[model samples]
Target: SHIIDVIECKTFEDLLATTQPLEEYLANAGCLRPLRRLEDKNLLVDDILMFQVLHRVRGPFERFRDGLRTLGVLDKIKGHPESFRPLLCWSPTMLTADLVDSLFTINLSPVGSNRRHAEEVGTQKLGTILAFATGANTVPPIGFFPQPSIEFLHQEQDTATPSKLPIANTCINCLKLPLHTSYRAFQENMDFALGNTHGFGMVKFLIVSHY
Candidate 1:
């Protein structure tokens, strides 16, 4: 039950100004003192701060975009293999299918998702995620997670226009839009394994193992 990493806020002043409830959560929880041991064992644990969670969810979108930001952040560190980042997100969730091809992103997909179960739009997205991750014609596994089955909301999520200052698109595919790079070609290659895979709150502390 050791957490592998955290993304700390930019500054104490900024965190305090934006997120008082989170400040209170950390202060009352005394999380750092109890987790010091786990922190010592995992090298990358020192790289991010656990407190960043507060600021990210302080306001609107009810932490939905914040959750996406967290997952996207996990995607960015796609090259780090020492540990994996487990996260909770609200909506418009993505699977790690595109990431596994990189030596780094493989660790991120402990459970895996697949568009094989989907039809139409969902299937297409999941397919894109899968093919991009595998780097081959071979279809990857797409099944339910053994424990904690996925619970997707029936309503389709509105694309919360990215927060101007905070959640700008980080997906390499997203960043390429300006260059007029053909994103459709990239889309055709991914596996959008849609399961209970992308959204889980309690899984955060389970991201890394002790031994």
Candidate 2:
């Protein structure tokens, strides 16, 4: 059975803190190539649940340093000369603000895909977080993994009984409701909304900014 650590956070620190335990727990559990869900109850099959931190949780990144330090998660990857694999999860508001282009000032306009949006957000806050951490002469350059969506290994709502799966789109999982997902087309509505790529970007962008 796979386990999911679903953690909701209001700050970057909280987000980083939550991930540490998850990293340790999963690493100890021998979980390699963590899996994630795309949309609906669909997962990458055998992957760890990644309730990733998003843009909205920004402020005083120092809070995350300790958790990261204790876990050595960042340290372990410092010399690899790479960035965290990109993910399309949350989009920040600053980049998508109505006046961002002029009225609002933020690098990288927030548009299309949740993962890229979050990457931009992380970039701003990471500077502060890394500076506060330790043994810091310079920070590793982090880049976003450009893709359509974030990797989400959605856990089965119920592990006991099996349920019928829709042969195609247009069918909702009767067994799961509130948390269950439905598809508008062949693609699973990951964000569970009534829109396409544009819609997804708008919705996720709002979420990353505010929440």
Candidate 3:
């Protein structure tokens, strides 16, 4: 039967509603073979179950699982399951002052006006924005921001038009912002762009401003 059909079945519904062990039920129904295969590859079954139960099976999760199954890494993972634990059970690291300082590389020269703007708003304000956007202020998942470092750029040339919004180059995990009229406007724009879901997809390296 299809996985969706199995999930929507009366037996599955009864299993969910009852105090019966889900694992046992699945095992009895021969539904746990795939899960066992994943476990054999050292994948965290609990985490997968949690993700399916809470967020449903997302595209990324499906792709990841499919990749694992297709790659034939069962023997490799079986040999060193412990090595994968750190990755599976990763603890979220909160954004700190030192981390903020180390996270971004300012592309502008020290004497440049753009550099001064970056220095003024990039350090503290950018950190705040990143923290908020990535949920670094609270407990965030490991997938929140995969890349630790970001390239900060202030391309004044790109801002020839005053109406142009900031540009985020996701390919290189670079945040290139156009010159704004004021600090407040810059902050507001950053907040709006980073915080909004439709602004940029999956902010892997914090605020990814785009035109």
Q: Best-fitting candidate, measured by lDDT? A: 3
Candidate 3 or 2, higher TM-score: 3
lDDT of 1 at 111: 31
Question: 1 or 3: which has the higher TM-score?
Answer: 3
Residue range 46-100, candidate 3, lDDT tens digits:
4335545654546777787667766676556667889877766777789999999
What are the RMSD figures for all models against the true structure? 26.0, 28.6, 21.3
Lowest lDDT sum, 10 consecutive residues, model 1, at 162-171
Ranking by TM-score: 3, 2, 1
CA lDDT scores, all candidates in order: 0.33, 0.37, 0.51
TM-score of each: 0.14, 0.14, 0.24
Off by over 4 Å in 3: 1-159, 162-164, 199-211
Evaluated against the true structure, the overall lDDT of model 2 is 0.37
lDDT of candidate 2 over 122-152, digit per residue (tens):
4554443222222122443552222112122
Q: lDDT (0-100) at residue 108 of candidate 3?
A: 59
Candidate 2: where are CA atoms >4 Å away? 1-59, 81-83, 87-211
Residue 104, model 3, lDDT: 88
RMSD (Cα, Å) of candidate 3?
A: 21.3
Candidates sorted by lDDT, best first = 3, 2, 1
- Give me the overall lDDT of model 3: 0.51
